[model samples]
Target: MSNSVPMTVEGHRRLQEELKTLIRVERPKVVQDIAEARSHGDLSENAEYDAAKERQGFVEGRIQELNDKIARAQVIDPATIKSDKIVFGATVTVFDVDTEKEATYQIVGEDEADIKHGKISITSPVGKALIGHQVDEEVRIVVPSGVRVYEITRISYT
Candidate 1:
């Protein structure tokens, strides 16, 4: 219920790295490109200037977004949290009730949710359903594909 965003320590580190790279490397490069493009004259006819301006806009927007997320982040270390029931930063293994397939996912922040990497956002449908659930409990999640039931097989803090 907190307004602060929950993110794993690794996710926070990654965001810090990206912010550093953008401010130290990309920002200056974009500024130089803009200046060089402007020197070519006729701003309306300059494609390089237009492209550079567009890239600058995107870069600035991303920088602001990263800064906000980092500032509001509540870094959670999974290894430090101990819980038998599923919670933020918990890694849960689930068995599909229909297909009988098993899958593992780590409940993470919105920015760290990469399904291919087995990380899901706590705000996600499945993540929300799994929260506070215990091992062997069945969870019903309504996803875009439709409703699916999963049985919690295991829960771990790390």
Candidate 2:
């Protein structure tokens, strides 16, 4: 990409680990699978060969994609930052205005987004609404499901 991809140190580390696995473990195993399939001799009728070739293509494509992401990554460590306003890497606790409950979400990069784990991408509707907001601030965000209202309660590095 022409622009750097913003991410947390943890997200960067995860991508690097995936890349390393694809290169060291997956690449060699796929290569061996291709060779073994090739030994079957009949190219057109070789289903194993076709499957192995497809797998190789997938692995190679993922490796290249991961390499590009890693090269363009702008890693930010949350633990190293201290900010009152919600920003990237900030773990925020929000009180739902309608649900009468509170939920915590970490503002993270796209690759680190996992709603199930309470990590929301900075570009997400809720995350966009939360940025630059401080504790006790009310935020209104329009999502695909509907509009959401949240009150910022806490902000933590971790």
Model 1 TM-score, 2 decimals: 0.96
Segments of candidate 2 deviating more than 4 angstroms: none
Clashing residue pair totals per candidate (backbone < 3 A): 0, 0
Candidate 2 is scored at a TM of 0.97
Q: What lDDT would candidate 2 get against the real structure?
A: 0.94
Q: Please name the candidate that would achieve the greatest TM-score relative to the true structure.
A: 2
Q: How far out, in Å, is residue 72 in model 1?
A: 0.7
Residue 53 lDDT (model 2): 94
Q: Please list the residue runs of candidate 1 whose C-alpha ends up more than 4 Å from where it truly belongs after superposition.
A: none
For 84-105, candidate 2 gives per-residue lDDT tens digits of: 9999999999999999999999
What TM-score fits each model?
0.96, 0.97
Q: Pick out the ten consecutive residues of candidate 1 with the lowest summed lDDT.
A: 1-10
